[model samples]
Target chain A: MWRPLAEAARELIDLCVMSDVDEDEVRAARADVEAAVARLRKVRRTQTLGQQHLTGGRRRPWGNPVIGLRNPIAPPLQVSTDPSGRAATEFHCGPAYEGPPGLVHGGVVSLLLDQLLGHAVGAAGRPGMTGTLTIVYRQGTPLGDLRAEAWIDREDGIKTWAKARMIGPDGVTAEAEGVFILPRAIRERSPSSPTGHIG
Target chain B: MWRPLAEAARELIDLCVMSDVDEDEVRAARADVEAAVARLRKVRRTQTLGQQHLTGGRRRPWGNPVIGLRNPIAPPLQVSTDPSGRAATEFHCGPAYEGPPGLVHGGVVSLLLDQLLGHAVGAAGRPGMTGTLTIVYRQGTPLGDLRAEAWIDREDGIKTWAKARMIGPDGVTAEAEGVFILPRAIRERSPSSPTGHIG
Candidate 1:
């Protein structure tokens, strides 16, 4: 039920962005959307924050903008990890994520890599906050299916470094490197663990 | 009309992420969302892509995820520019953008900086594509009112560099440096112009 609703919401956004129907039709659609919103608000939310786990035992990121299955804003990328702790996912971008004409937004590319690198670091049993992320765009990522992957580069003291890249239909379009650091608080608490939980 | 609709959509997403009401209520909400989608689809959209302008003469980014007034996924950031081409905005992030409990998602931070840097470069009359962006997270950005700013650092031939930072209630939460480049195609098209256009 959530999946369908999310998909529907995505389609609505696409329509909102691209639609050029008459103003009357737009008004009608707005009315429908408002009504739907009113109905959804009839219930109260629990307000408890969601939990984030390391990739080794990651849960569904229901509200995540990159991979959350229940988030309409998400491309909802499905990530798969190998035994070696490398992470990868394949997903498609639509007009809703456009920056340049018919191309994926650079921020969207960064968002995908950030999450992928975080997962890769966690899968390797070292979870930490994102200290720094550096991304390079080699070419424009077209709005369509693409493949992305990330892996651990090295670990130095409290920092775990990871690398990632995105491959568009034509070729490699973007690459990224991220530094994940175990906060002082987390390090003190765990003592023995290389790192704590990641975001 | 678009603003209210976008706000309503944002509220709905927050509900979807945080709600823990009865299953019957969830089902009912889903039905309403589905109905809204069905009504929205009654009209076909004009397939023309939207135009993006340089920040020097920027238009409202109605579909942009960072500052688009009509985009629900956007924080709807309202950026103001100084005569020197510095860009700044004050906005709020709600629970819909949470990552680590009460904190703003790291990816969301990247997204905001990416757009801010792009605008800064464009406002400098040297707009280019995001070639590279390096971000350092100094602390967690809490999900609430915050301020972000960006400015041009330097320009070299085909590249324009910019710097930006996000300030939470406590202090600086994150900072970034971006390298924007004028692609060969764009450069060739507007030979005399220092840079053609930006995304």
Candidate 2:
């Protein structure tokens, strides 16, 4: 049911990212999109904020811009968690994500690291909003199949630290460390909470 | 000219971000987009890489993802340079950029800061690629009008250091420091060059 909608959205994003149409075609396409938006806006007014997950919820994919299966901005990422609770994913970045001539955008690299690190922390039973993130770019990440891995580094009270790296065909292209904070509401609810919600 | 193309692209992105359509509607809209893409692909084959800027080039608007006037992913940013060479921009983050509930996404903040800090370095006559970016999130940045500023902190040989901050309605929301490196090609071309091309 939702798969087709996501696929269509991905097609739309691809067109927007690299399409080169003339003025007449662009105007025509723009009008079509505007009409769709007007119709959709009517439906949105009837819906409310979706559900929030605390812990052990259904293992449904999210709509995150970086790793969400339903997000067109994301590449097709296939993530898995090992028994030891490390999270890893493999995917390919296409021309739509290009920043430099042949390299993936640096911000996109950060986005992937943030999502991977967050997932690693969540798998370790601690999830929170990003408090700080530091990214180091070792080399240009080319647009192609790549691998990423992340794991928990340490945990201190309400903060959890994690590190992740992106590997290109050559070698490590970027690395990151992040501190995620458990919200006050969650902390007040469970003093010894190991699993929490992620933002 | 390019304006209409950019405007159309922005419109397409907006629809992709928030539009809610049923399965049948998605299929119809997807077909429309696919046809447009077929025409646009032909047009793209005729185009080449656009222009590049060295030092003191005309301050023309670019299509950058974070601050480009033609980029829909960007919040509306109005920037100006001060006498001391600081770059400041004021803008608003809408729901389209939300990550956490009622707050702007951390990566969005980093993207804006990266662009702002990069612009500050370029304005100071040392455009280069981002080597490292370290961001500290002081608080959850609420979604609304905000202000950001960046400027050169120091420089050594081929490295330029810059700092930037994002302020929400309350106070400081996030801050960042980055080290940008002038490529060897640029450094070798001008032994003491303060400005180079940005990748």
Candidate 3:
């Protein structure tokens, strides 16, 4: 139900950033967008929490800004795990995700790596929250089709160390190392539990 | 002109996530949003790059995802420098920015810190691109009124090290340390030049 709306909203965002419309046209578009907002606000979700679990056993958060299906801000990356136990995704960004000139936002890259690392750790049968994330940008991530991959580096007690990298047309652009830790609550309750609060 | 559209887009996003509208209502809203996108796409910007400098000498990027007035994905943070040369902003995140149940997304925190560190380094008369960023999540950042601050820790040749933190109601939820470096192109041109590409 929401996938179409989110897709349309993403289109609207890209147009908003990359278009050269005049103020008169801008006003017209704004009016239409406002009408949509008004109509949607007629009903509010009293229970927005725990809605992700209700999505038929899927772990995807529909409103995540990086990979949420219902989120317009996300490139809505479709990540898949290889047989070798590595998570990977190939995605594209338009002008809406621009940081400098013609380049993807550095923070956007961080957001992608964070999500990819989370997926890698979760694929390892140990879901955890992000404790420490370190990113090294080797070159500017251009705004276009890009590839990213992540794998578990090691595990230390309650912590899981992971590594990931973003590849642009020019090979490696950025690399990340993260330490994800099981929340104390989940660890205290059941150390072997795969379900826990994750970022 | 894009401000109103971006603002309305943000409102629509919040409503999309936090609302309980039915399929019929969702369809109605989707149509309106599609109309807006169609209208806005009638014209395309021939030159989208380097448009930031056209904004009346202001350093702000109108389409920036973290603090862009024309970017809806941003909480659209307005950062200010204090008398002590620290960068700070007080902002709020709605349901659109949620990650873990009721807390702000961890990557969203990283985005804010990245932009704050950029502002801090720029404020110190040393504009550069992000080299490395490290974030430590001490606690979950809540989804409401929050505060963040950044300052230059030191400068080593063409590299500037900075520190920042996000403060929720419970105290500091996350701390970030970033290393910003003058790009090789800019460094070769003039090591003392303040005008250069930044993250």
Candidate 4:
């Protein structure tokens, strides 16, 4: 149901950034866009507000902008879990994500790495919020198909450390390490099982 | 000229992510959007493509997405330079940037910090590409108005080290350090001068 809307929205976003329309044409376009917004507002009035946060471990493929199926900001991600517990996703950065001419935005690369690391932690049964993240850009990430992989490095108490890397067509474009913190509520529920050190 | 276009595009992006219309309404909206896109395409065919990278020493307030004047993804950044050469910008995050329940996306915070540090380095007479960035999230950054400050920590050869912090209404939300690499072209121009250390 949402797939088509997401595709359309993505196209719209791409046009907005890359197009070079003149003022009069842009004004005309704006009027059309305003009309569409009004119609959308009318439909929105009938639905209740959505839950603000993810809950219950129910996978939300469409909840995050980084991997969300219904988010135009997201590059299409195809994720798979390895039997050994690593998480990997194959995706692409198109012209809409352009930063330095042909290169991907540095922030967008960070976002992908953050999501990959978080997903790796969750795949290992220890999902948490990001506490710290460090990234090293080895080379400019070109706007094209790419692959990313992440795995848990280790764990200490309530924190899980994970590492991830993004691979462009040539080679490694960026690498990252992130610290994720398990919330207190979840920590309390799993006490005595093992509070520290995950291999 | 570009201002109004950016404004319109931003509105389009916000509506794309936040709107919750049904399939039929989405289809209708898509038609209107398509018309706008067609018009934009017509205009784009008549103009030359823009320069692919930043050049000269001209300051482009609308260059980077984190603080670009015409970028909807950007928070409105009103920057002021201090007498001591530190750079500061005051801005706000809206619902469109939401990641956690009421908090800003961690990546968004990182983007802001990256820009702040880069801006500070540029303000200090050394601008370059990001080599590395490390961010520590002390607390969840709530979505609303905030302040960010960045300044040069030191310099080594062609590398500039900088630090920045994001302050929310409560207190400090996130802090970061980054290393930026000055290109060889710029480095060669200033080789005769002292190439190490900065207060």
- For residues B1-199, what per-residue lDDT tens digits would candidate 3 score against the true structure? 8899999999988877777889999999999999999888999886553354544444558788888888888888999985344899999888788787778888888888998998888777677778999999999998899999999898899988989999999999999999998666666775455552267
lDDT of 2 at A50: 16
Chain B TM-score against the true chain B, each candidate: 0.86, 0.76, 0.90, 0.81
Q: Give the alpha carbon lDDT tens digit for every residue of A26-45 in model 4.
A: 78877776766676666442
The candidate that wins on lDDT is: 3
Candidate 4 residue pairs that clash? none
DockQ, all candidates in order: 0.53, 0.37, 0.70, 0.39
Q: How is the predicted docking of candidate 1 categorized under the CAPRI scheme? A: medium
Each candidate structure's TM-score, on Cα atoms with residue i matched to residue i, is 0.89, 0.83, 0.93, 0.85
User: In candidate 4, which residue ranges exceed 4 Å CA deviation?
Assistant: A43-50, A53-63, A190-199, B43-63, B76-78, B82-85, B190-199
Ranking by DockQ: 3, 1, 4, 2
True A-B contacts kept by model 3: 0.74
TM-score of chain A of 4: 0.83
Clashes of each: 0, 2, 0, 0
- The residue-by-residue lDDT of candidate 3 on A107-184, one tens digit each, is 888888988898888777656879999999999998889999999999888888989999999999999998998666
Which tens-of-lDDT digit does each residue in A1-199 have in candidate 1? 5666677777777666766566666666677666666666676554423443333354456777777766778888888875455999998887777776667778888988998998888777677779999999999998878999999999888888999999998889999999998666656775444342357
Which stretches in model 2 have alpha-carbon errors above 4 Å?
A1-6, A45-62, A76-78, A188-197, B1-17, B20-24, B46-63, B68-79, B82-85, B189-197
Report every candidate's CA lDDT.
0.76, 0.66, 0.83, 0.68
TM-score (C-alpha) between model 2 and the true structure: 0.83
